[model samples]
Target: MDEKLIQRLESAIARLESLSPGSKPPSGTLDAVSAASEPSIVAYDDLLVEYVVKVSLAAEKIGGQVHDITIVLSQAFATQKELLMKIKQTQKPDGGGMTEFLKPLNDKLAQANNMSEGKRSDFFNHLKAASESLSALIWIAYTGKGCGKQKLLLLTSYFPIFNINLASKQQLFALIFSGMSMPIGHVEECWQSAEFYNNKVLVEYKNKDPYHVEWAKALKELYVPGLRDYVKAHYPLGPLWSTTGAVVSAPKSAQPSAPNPPSASLANLASSSSSRPKQGQGMAAVFQEISSKPVTSGLRKVTDDMKTKNRKDRAGFVSSGENEVQKSAPKTAAKTGPPKLELVMGRKWVVENQIGVKDLLIDDCDPKQTVYIFGCKDSVLQIKGKVNNITVDKCTKMGVLFTDVVAAFETVNCSSIEVQCQGAAPTISIDNTAGCQLYLSRESLETSITTAKATEVNVMVPSSDPDADLAEHPLPQQYIHTYQDGNFVTNPVSHSGG
Candidate 1:
């Protein structure tokens, strides 16, 4: 066992005792996750090398960032590999969690509690960008393609699968901690007990889930091969990929052979594994569920509430305009303001009314479908949802609160912009922010920013390993150039609907 690593893991757990809710560390804690380089990778055998390189190249074709897989994702697999090897020796699982998985993100958010909306938004945007940029890479990894050679390397020490004791449990822990949500289905292999149903997180495992526990063959057979198939179909590239030898020069030892596409031979892998999920049976995503829908009752209810609010908010927004506030910026503040909204979830939610009075804490908001919030000022605001076109109107003394969100929450016109998302891509337009704080996420949107406003744009990735950048991050920012209409945006915000 690597005693130092164990000690570090133990110490990280120890710090949780003093940890409180919403606690965050000082600045520079979160490095630009997307911008982070790959971890120190051990070279792979030739066959694996060629295939992995092809996989990496395929990722670029699919619009996924290849480096994220090489850097963030490859490291995740490496970490899992190292931990699993230790587990096999002891034949026991390590324990400790929640904070173990989430503390890095939580700690930072807590620290920024007092930041003004502008400052908070800047921070949040960066975090969101890093997380989002890593999405596809993560999904590819989750499928177990990344786990292959590591498993092979450990078993034979020669890089071929034999006498393998798969690390399903450890992999699950790694996946969840990597910001992938827990699937509601039973884990056939190894799982202690952690559920993420809606925003209400539920995690309960004694000593946290262990790092070194190997799963049984029966269960492993049921899971691994199917996952390999999924990886073959979707990502096809490698957490293990290396480029062609002749094209790129490396020390002869590290040089890759000619790259060949994934061959048909890999398709039959599950043959020996035993009753895997048949195509429609959804076994392909053995470790995790394929559907993006919420599985648990708790998650469903939360999604329901979000949709319900969207309906109401959409209604209100379509019906009313902040007629009192003129389109043109006023030299002097208006004495009279628009009608006040109830300013709570469900009742006055959907953010159509005067937003200056109340803070916005919303979740599951669909950016493509509705215009959620616009033109608010001088209030603490926190909105959580999938990334979509957001038109943030002007606000003085504005404050935006950012919690760790699953998707991108790109804003259009907020004076101060900060976004932090896990597995989300966030973009900010320079059309509005000038001399305003703009900490856009690491993989920010494409629109040009002419201003040199002390905008604080940086990617804040939440990882115990400062270098860990996620692969399955967010999508690109949708920039529709049309101007805002009123309390509602006039531009069509649809992206994937096409």
Candidate 2:
């Protein structure tokens, strides 16, 4: 086991123990205690109801903040025309300029002192951060600069909340349904703006500097996950009729009836019956009636209806005549093969599911095109010309030789992958990968390489002397990060060579 993981588990156990009852009572004594004195165990249905109510209330509060942030973003876009124009005119990717441009928007956000405090403060802060991310993304897509840190901030800050494995469903749903609902229009507009930038501005600089395309691509990636979450959270409500069901009634004889005088005149009997309590008129009967009906919600009804429809469809298909089933089976069984290497929209090259193929090549790639290699095993791919970016994903024992990448060369979720770059690549990123070997030619020696959750990464660079062997540098896999003076400072583990 990893030492860090062991420490984390130990810490979690300590916390749990601290929160547990101080000492366990004798086993028999617990059962002997009076049930009335013991704390009531909340039912799952009651807890779920409480949680839903709390989430709904929180959503409303957060929705207001989101609405305010949307207005701020819109105002910034409209009033800061001069700054935007300056951003367009600027040729360099200056992080400082981007910060300055965002100051006004941040100031407006800071003035929202009406926001409540405490744990809710964290939610408001996240809302502000998300707004800033969205605004920065739009600006980056518009100006085609500030692609480095701003894009990284957006990915790191907001993207993880959308991960189902990392966040609770309620949390994810609340954030998407509340924080993003109001700003969805703006998000769409930003997407359109990015597409326009990709088609118009980046196309002109296809040969000289196509790295600006990364901003557009990053914006698109950010938008897609949030959009997916939005769809999940905003599923249509079930019809009201679906929640309605026949109420179960008690038997007629079992119901309580009014008392009648046994030996009295007819008029006296009527008077006595009128004064007595009638059947099913008291609170107990009302309670009984309420308990007899099944509890359900519209959402649950819709989900159940959908499941029933699916089961019925399957049953109908299974019960079909043999000839009819055989005739329809061919259509269901026939499936297309996984996609091969192809260019999409004249901008992206998708290569997928090629196994044990050695001769894969993209000889005529332009600087505006991005290459995506996915699920290729024991394959060697060669790109003969410059491309905007390249991503190698989920591959094993794959070798990639590329001439140049104007933006970034990224490898994600792969093992035993080797990449060689003969020309310049501004950035090379390895993520969730293992056993990566990167060979950088003299012309590409200045490339910036970044890695996260990766191991066994070695970079080979040509030595100063032409006759000397290439110098191999292994990237540090372990690091220590400490909070100091407000920010975290990270340092790689020390070795004897240092």
Candidate 3:
């Protein structure tokens, strides 16, 4: 929201476009570049990839509900797309016909006679712009298509303090997996509501609901060395707020004028209304142009002629310079897929590196991967954390136990998840986590938890009192409490407090 900050981020897009143009970068390049201990690109240069992924997420119909970040990002995507169009236009002959290619030669002759060097300089400028634009697009497109979107969306949904939501079923996902966090503190922001015409305000927590405190406690568990860690190690992605999966619109056949940014409104980039059209749609359209189009048979003769001419020219210009030993050395190809991965349908697997996967399925199997996500709605997940940072989804007859150091656990659009926190610092984030509880435990105390998106999250934190009897302090109605008595235990209620 700061004026100076807006001006800084606003110039970032232009700097990125000016740097290079070509197809987008390779799929793993962005991640590899970002994750390196030392990054090659400077501060705002990172925003380029993030915006492209946002566009790709939009193409897949995901929206980040945060207003300011999305507005800035959407406009950035538009600006880059327009620049790419110009680069493409510059490569093609103007006024296309049989006479188009001859114009360059004619211009060269005209320049030689008139002693005008502007055409010569202009030729190099176009090449420079195209090279930069094409390269930028390639990196952006690869990230948008290959980034693990499902995990990214799930990670940001749990914290109640953040203003974000899933707008439609398209944004909804099933089959999450995870475990463990420790409850820590209370919120002291001193937020309040207004009174009447007396012009006074009442402080919040005046009524002091115990249930509210419990919720806050659970939420705080997620706040520390949290999802931000996951994001920092990857792209600086903004949280997605909506799920209205918009269709990727095809590119227009007829050329349109390049989109121009508002000259006086660099500060207003935060306005949600100022965002450009769906960029993922435009990127997808461009992708179609690059991938699906086939060269015509008629163009083959022209291509062969160009290659033969190049060969003849090279042979005439240079003598042979290759040594017999150097020529015999084998060329190396790049490696793809996880180099250390070992797989099977059976259990017992160990992996110490990050695993990038999509539409991933693992049923009746043990856990130990970086991220596991749901592609189909009916997909089931088994969240046994032999690895770290997981989401437990669709908890029907499932025993959700929090053990060890689980930074955050979020559940949404699934059946029922059993609640049991026996871990150190666990935050159970319930966003649209419907159904009911199958269990709750005592160790949930001192764990920070937050809730958002979901209508209700059923938490079952039991009393760990040694001397106190059940008859002395009656349990609250929200608890599914039980004790060693005359078989008289019912309803979930009455949790412990700090």
Better of 1 and 2 by lDDT: 2
Candidate 3 has what TM-score?
0.26
Q: Against the hidden reference, what TM-scores do the models get? A: 0.22, 0.38, 0.26
Flag clash pairs in model 2.
none
- Could you tell me the TM-score of candidate 1? 0.22
Model 3, which residues run further than 4 Å from truth?
A: 1-166, 169-387, 395-397, 438-443, 467-498
Q: Which lDDT tens digits does candidate 2 get at residues 1-498?
A: 265346446545654554468956553333223211212211212322333233333334435554454344334433333333233223333334334444554454333322322222212333433343343323222222223344333232323434422212343344333432223443554454334323322333345433433322332444444332332243212001112322222345644589984778989889777655567589776676556766662234356656756666656445657999899777744532364999888888988878888999999789878888887889999999998878888899999999988877888789999999999987788877999999999999888786867899999999999999999999999999999999989999877975
Candidate 2 weakest lDDT stretch, 10 residues: 235-244
Could you say which candidate leads in lDDT? 2
Decide which is better by TM-score, 2 or 3. 2
Identify the runs in model 2 with alpha carbons over 4 angstroms from their true place. 1-339, 483-487, 496-498
* Cα-based lDDT for every prediction: 0.33, 0.55, 0.32
lDDT of 3 by residue, 1-498 (tens): 265356446445434544467646663443333222123122223444433333334323312221222233334334433322222223322222212222232222222222211222211211221111211111211112223232223222221213322432222232123211111110111000000100100111113233322322222221222222323443333212113322222235433568996576656665544444456677766666556556673263556647755766656554555674465443311222232323333432222112232223323333232222221132223333333334444333333443433334445444544545454435455545555352334454665554444434455554557555322222222546576566758775545696
Which model is ahead, 2 or 3, in terms of lDDT? Answer: 2
The alpha-carbon deviation from the true structure for residue 347 of candidate 2, after best TM-score superposition, in angstroms, is 2.9
Q: Which ten residues in a row have the lowest lDDT in candidate 1?
A: 195-204
